[model samples]
Target chain A: MASADNVGILGWGAYIPIYRISSDEIARVWGFDDKIPDSIWVEEKAVGAIDEDTVTMSWEASRYALMRSGIDPSEIGAVFVGTESKPYSVKPTATIVAEALGIPPKKLASDLEFACRAASEAIRISIGLVKSQIAKATLVIGADTAQGAPGDLLEFSASSGAAAYIIGNPNQAAAVIVASNSYITDTPDFWRRDGAPYPEHGEIFTGEPAYFHHIVNAVNGLFEEYGFTPKDFDYAVFHQPNGKFPLQVGAKLGFDREKILPGIVTPYVGNTYNGSALLGLAKVLDIAKEDEWILVAPFGSGAGADAYAIRVTDKIEEKRSLAPTVEELIKRKILISYGEYTKMRGKIRKYER
Target chain B: MFKDSVPKYWRLRDVVYRLKYIYCRDCGKSSFPPRSKCPYCGSSNIDHRYSKGNGVVEEYTVMYQSEARYQDYQPIVFGVIRLDEGFRIVAPIVDVDPNSVEEGMRVEATLRRVRVDGSTGLIQYGIKFRPSRR
Candidate 1:
């Protein structure tokens, strides 16, 4: 029965796999011509090895968040992991992560499933929990290991990564959660059938029906609901299944390309499903100035969106010195060949016996 | 064949090299591997101090032999020493015959190789204590 406005993001962390799969290599293997863009817009996509999954990635991201926030794990009242791919069909991945982090058992904990928008929803839920005084702090994690049907355009961009945020009251916060809005629809633009190995998406349909429509409506709805305009935001990050979508949507919303450029993590990391948009937002927060406004919109496959407006605080500038930024992470050298990508993504087996 | 668990360089140059450990000024508790604040007091007030690297032998053990890769050195002598600073550290002891090992003997820290990290290709140094010559 608590309001979400009372809760704010206290700390944020991100993780992109060390290995990179060049779009050029993808094009070469797929037999696409040299004229095709290396990444439809960016140059490469990050690929996690076979050993990593949503759970492992969330653990790493949360480690960074806990370290940066200096928040004791025992103080957290809730643990929420939002992902499309659960490590197990029935067991809650959140419980596993909570146990690994040594968080106390007497806490509110659950896994959220809403396609890519689940993480944003988790954030909203944490805000409400803090507002109602039911919980003093919550750790919201978004992660995914998105698999695309072989030879599809999605294969080139669907990769794995994760992001996490510690949300709590403003007095104990690092950034203020200014406002948020949700744009929902029952459009099934993309989906994976039961037991299907990969997701099936309506290519051109996904563009207008889900990505464009939902993002535009969400941004506009947040503006209408909060009485703010595009110019008021310093950065706008959308669920980037591919690099071009966020830029295309930003242009439609009257935002300058530069404003959204810093939040575009897909060019280097690919679509991390639930973590895509939030990863971009985390990067922006790394270099954002105090009081700077940031807008985030995450669109899911079945068709739903969550948009949030946040303002950076002095704590952000203070915490900036403690952790590595997206730029620093980007400078690490990790190269994977086309064959390795196939192996890492489980497209091919090494021991076909 | 058993693979060499440690690298040749680390085995040859055994120094327990770590970022210096710091102790809390308010609470004389020592921190291993070093930290900016004391975990006990949560105070950033701390100072770096070197371990005397000498201690009383708390326990001792002997390995009749090791895996094939390390077979050249048979009957290894390993021991744990309780340092004057109130911490227990484990290391291999050399110079004294393995059959002559005994507990409560005074020992001093000595440099020796620990292991090899395949990725970085560098020798890791560790502290091994030997009976004090004095």
Candidate 2:
């Protein structure tokens, strides 16, 4: 979906919650097998405070995006939030985020729900919005306070974080979107029924049939669409469910570990669900060089994928100081106990009045 | 004592979302919790303004006692922030130890869930100050 116009990411920002709980600690609390954490390939996961949720995280991230873009928030015409854990099931997360960012009251806003790919879809729509001259710019966000049932295997990787991008013309862009493609299906590898507190996955079924299938199809489609091969990309970022998924998928796509390592954050931050792949892209955008081609593929369960080919621009270096980099937020963390994590995440239930 | 109807929450969204204040063009004085008319000069020459959310603690107090709805987060600390814009505001301080906060300490506003409405079980989100981490 590379638009005819230069509809690329003008600015990018990310927010990782300050609190974290190590996999070892979660394992210890649950009395799980010591070997299980190793299989997840994650050391720790970000945990939002009880006061924080998808709306707050998305707003913070959007603030940084506005700072980096150096655009009046009111000038932007669209605000889209992609998340699986929106605070209110019916209320749109986009309006709260737009208001917090000082975006104009009259604009398009919506909460997209397609698992993790919702934000990526928002990005594609932003490209269309900017290309059609319908908007001066558009804000697309991916964020989540992802949860797994207590003592469940998914707990090791479910995490909280957010990433946002302001997409506009190349004059203000950090990178130009060279091309994009998506693959979708009725795969229900992961889902949370209405009123369910945490999501459930089909274990191995989440791997082969859902994540891998969508990602490979979308990326292969991108390659075919643009007549480009893996060697043309300087770096590759695949959706990271666990630390291993990105690397495994990257290898399958003919990318080396070195090319994929820089974009992978789940090893330390765990999976941020909707924020997972976009945050990785933010990390790449933070360090990518002029004309370097970076391939990003986001796979969301239930399930679909969006693959993007982006070429970095020199402007990225100039806007780096406008907001805190993703690395800075990732490093600004304090380790919390499993008990403290529960308290901060509000997992503790109250029984007394 | 934190029960809010939906309209009240929506009405005060500007105060919490981005610290949007109002400037009295007639007197050049700024007032928060935006007003329809200028407070200082009693004039209608008012303009919308924003606070950078950076300030210093003018005074602070720690409360160990709490209401039933806030028992989980007891010992709440509140401060009067002397903002860079030359106005002062009272707000709860977070992400810092309750006892460590002192007057003249640097603080920044961050969006957070302030209190939950007990009657409606709806959460109220607002700006809360915290020690400037940077």
Candidate 3:
């Protein structure tokens, strides 16, 4: 449903780690051919430091969101972190983020898991909260340090990053949330068992049956309900499992390649999983002009997808520079070796008493 | 024997999370790791404040040795930062080359994993500094 009230994005921010490992490095170590990275359309992927995790990245991104919005931490009514890579299995990552941001004792705080679409769901939930007046504003974060087996194709794409947004009154928003909806199913194209460190996928089954099916259905659901066509939007961002999937999906949905190109980030930073589509939206927000329309479709392989129609406002020009832009964060990189990547990712066993 | 205590970390959450300080209104100075009594003027009249997180490195050193738990993150650069507001606190510098850090370099605060008790214990998170872009 379209928000009855004026619920919009107050601010947006992203955090990408500086460390990087090329697809070539991963390929060489695993005895894969050189064209493997090219086949996936990923050159390099961002890596979190040994000391960093989902919680720390979420805090950094949220801090910037607060800075851009100029909102006091106590005023936030809800906090949500969507990730598959939470540091602790039982402890909540959201409380740690809320506390680090000084968001006070009274707030709706919890972690949500839907593979990758959890943060997208957080945004949809925040829109409802603001529309109903249950909260004046809310913080929604998408972050991940996704895992892949040593010799698996996922190793080239499972990376780390975070994107955060503040949802509040439309009058204070940089971009208004026109409408949003989600589509989900019992499709199990990708999964990791409860205690498994690395996830397994259904290979090509992840493409058409999982990612494409859920995302197309979600976007079509919005189009059918809202009467919006592909031509109506100035830009479209899809969950980027690789550099090629977004373009392929966009083409399938009748959107031009040009409209989807600006939002594709997986080629450079790898698939930040939760951060993939959100980070693309953040980049578009940084460069989009007043009144421009953006189509956001984020898919998670459990599987599900959330589609949002966003309209930019004049406030974007002023608020865009309040925090570091996604492009700038992506450029601040230090390439590491395959061995270093293994170390940072904790692939090595450690001794303990 | 105890590796660490939850109460110790919980009690100092504010300071640990945000780098909080107590500004002695009477003395016009800020004391970090905030306390009820001001160290400079011995006054109880103080207000809790958070550092703007902008600072400059006053001095720094790289530690190649540490307790076993911290071995994964060795060659850690420890620096004494003087916040833009003019109070000094020591913290680890991350996201940059350890050998490249120098005196008077600009820095900014960021939350990070300070330590973890073990596989089953709490993961303590606190404020750390990194090279500032602006």
Per-residue alpha-carbon lDDT of candidate 1 for residues B1-134, written as tens digits (9 for 90 to 100): 22344554333321243224667889878765566898779888898765757678889898887754233234667898777776566777754668778999998754333432332343244456667643
lDDT of 3 by residue, B21-116 (tens): 989989999878898899999999999998889999999999999978888888899999999876899999998898799999999998889998
In model 3 chain A, where is the ten-residue run with the lowest total lDDT? A1-10
lDDT of 2 by residue, B1-134 (tens): 44468888888888887888888878888888788987778888888888989999999998788877776666778899988987789998876767688999999888887777763466678898878756
Q: Please, what are the lDDT tens digits per residue for candidate 2 over residues A1-353?
A: 33433576888989898888899998998999888778879989999887889988998888888888878887789999999998887779898888877888879999999997899999999988998989889999999999888999999999999999998886778898878888999998999999888888888999999988899999999888878799989989988999988888888888999999999899889899889999999998888888898999998888899888888888888888888878888898878888888887778886646
- Computed on C-alpha atoms, the DockQ of candidate 2 is 0.52
Candidate 1 local lDDT, A167-251, one digit each (tens): 9878656778877788889988888876677888887899898889998898898888777888889998888988888999999
**lDDT by residue for model 3 (A1-353), tens:** 44433588999999999999999999988999999898889999999999899999999899888888878888899999999999999989999999888898889999999998999999989988999989989999999999989999999999999999999989998999898879999998999999999998999999999999999999999888888899889999999999999999999999999999988888999999889999999989989999999999999988999888999999999999999999899899999998888888899987784
* Better candidate number, 1 or 2, judged by TM-score: 2
Residue pairs in steric clash, candidate 1?
A2-A132, B10-B113, B11-B113, B14-B111, B14-B112, B14-B113, B15-B112, B15-B125, B15-B126
In CAPRI terms, where does candidate 2 land? medium
Q: Residue B91's C-alpha lDDT in candidate 1?
A: 72
* Docking outcome class, model 1: incorrect
| Most DockQ-accurate candidate | 3
Clash count for each candidate, listed in order shown: 9, 1, 0
